[model samples]
Target: MKELIPLRLSILGHPQRLAVFRLLMRRYPDQVPAGEISDALKVKSSTLSSYLSALLQANLVTKTREGTSLRYQVNMETTRETLDSLYLDCCRGRPDLCTSYQQPVAPKERHMTDRKYNVLFLCTGNSARSIFAEAILKSKGQDRFEVYSAGTQPQSSLNPIALEMLKAKGHDTSALRSKHMTEFIGEGAPDFDFVFTVCDQAANEECPTWEGQPISAHWGMPDPVKATGTHAEKSLAFHQAYGVLQHRLQGFAALPFDQLDRISLQNAVDEIAKTSD
Candidate 1:
């Protein structure tokens, strides 16, 4: 039997260091020198050195002395042990809770409890990115998810470019109309199971925000509606936004909703952002 390397998230407490651990895991089985990890994560050498040192101390990662360079690799042995310990500690009764979510169930067979998740997508304008997301999820999740989209400052009409592309993808647009976020509020409104902001929050642009989403994250994408150029260039912007949303939605759709706790659910939603194209 293989011995377990002690795993402690407290040692890699900061988001930056935890990010470094994830980065190394993404490139697992291939050792990454400190310089490469620093460049990829945009952290300074001094700063990255500190993060790496903590990870090493926690035994969450392994280091190789390859001549003058110190290459780093995720300690898979430690990761496996830590996850096993976590499951033992938390999944005493729920076997499905700790099982991997990679194997997605078919729409008809999934969510056997007859639960239909209420999902909301938001942006400053209802026209483009949010619209793209609603259509994508409706198509991908089929009848399993009740998907809706709205804007902080609702537009009187949907973006024509976005509509054109949706039609190109063979998505029906008759039911999708631009609307304000308030419509979902007031009495007798469905409580959203998932809320996502699809606008470019990273640029500090004005995007919608909501409280108590249960599970929420910013799946931010550039506002293709703001793009100015030739028709083809503008179309390209919307196309890229569609690709990013489609990829992220695929991740969201595969999650085992019945098998996750609030902490696990929140982590899964946040991790889906990494799949951004």
Candidate 2:
């Protein structure tokens, strides 16, 4: 007769189950819907539900009733224990491999006593990509970063498509305007930490070196305004550019600025710029 192990111990022994558990760990406390998990992992919903049920039975996940939808979140206490057990098993009694278990660190506080770094976005016309990036980053980055945008040769106005997209995305576009970069070059200009040129021409043009010697980067995105197609096609291009900028900026805000030297930080920013292309 085979010996029976405790349920918690038995669940930990299964590698397939552990993978699902780790997926939840990555999105912890977010209460993912089962359908999203199925879509993200390319698993059939029926099969995924069985796995989720097993996890629930093992107390590794908790399900909450959200109207007609069921939401699943990681049971943190159980998750910590499982991680502790795995760490011990993997280390093989090596103290160097497994340090004392500590509570996971929270995201760093955004409060900076030092003057906030000013970030400037530049392009030729500043009607589309540059405008979208400036608005999105300013709205989403909040207290973590200060942001601005200007054009080498200012446009008559902000792009209507860009303004509509921003409004659709729940961002306030009321205060946004198109302005010339020259306005920012004088003695009273706010010193910038980063100056990102969002178009190839503007990036190539010689400009005054910004005060504070801001780290410069080129994020060359194709101009959505140049799309020669149906209205839907032009709008789609703006949406795509917005998504690319949002993803890169979110990653930028999460960077460990304090821990990295100037060169390393520039490299990291450059790597993020590639994702937009």
Candidate 3:
């Protein structure tokens, strides 16, 4: 136990190694490709290898092969054991002193008004894909970004299938409604920071000019409304659209926005659309 404690401490002592551990911790049960981790942390291949080697020696991480790629995953059980040991040393049998361990709140957990980035999702009818994007982002973004959805030709109401899918996923559907993209035009409209077109038709059409010239991308997908099949098959199409949007939005939320420049952020968003589909 004495030897293992020092070994784990040594592995975590380096800043770069600690950063990699934290990244792997965030991913937890899901393993990440080594290349992706390298890109995300901005560490060179040689440097990352050294860091990963230290972690592996201490049993702080695990690796598995997927097809041709090697994926690294956090050894969460070992991590928790190490933490428990450290806490025991500090508490020294005083149960009251180590009753709970609170994780430090992150900067992104701050109030939305403090540092809110506005996002707009555009589609042909603002019915299914756009509405799904809005709900998913609003729910997952956790006040880090303000999200709105609109269409070139607004529908009178939200699509039923879309509402059903969201509701099944425990998202509130009462207040969601369809609206025209024109609402974002003229004075008093939000100067968006990012804009995403989720339908091929909307992506091909000319969009209204925004005040801030937001970073825009087309995450184009087939319209769920046009799915012509059995009730089960049609509903499945909406579910799939929800899934693709969820994957893309999760990827976006995971980005280190504070560290990435506009060009990099644009590239990341584009890459997500390509890979998520």
Q: Is candidate 1 or candidate 3 better by lDDT?
A: 3
Report the Cα lDDT for residue 29, model 2.
Answer: 36
> How close to the true structure is residue 199 of candidate 2, measured as C-alpha lDDT?
72
Q: Give Cα-based local distance difference scores for all models.
A: 0.75, 0.73, 0.79
For candidate 1, give the lDDT of residue 20. 87
**Poorest lDDT segment (10 consecutive residues) of candidate 1:** 201-210
Q: List the residue pairs that clash in candidate 1.
A: none
- In model 3, the runs with Cα more than 4 Å from the true position are 1-114
Please provide, for model 1 over 38-93, each residue's C-alpha lDDT reduced to its tens digit, 9 standing for 90 to 100. 77778999999999998887788999989999999788677766776666754663
Q: Output the worst ten-in-a-row residue range by lDDT, candidate 3.
A: 102-111
Q: By lDDT, rank the candidates, best first.
A: 3, 1, 2
What value does the lDDT take at residue 16 in candidate 2? Answer: 62
Residue pairs in collision within model 2: none
- Candidate 1 segments whose C-alpha is farther than 4 A from its true place: 1-112, 201-213
Clashes of each: 0, 0, 0
lDDT-better candidate, 1 vs 2: 1
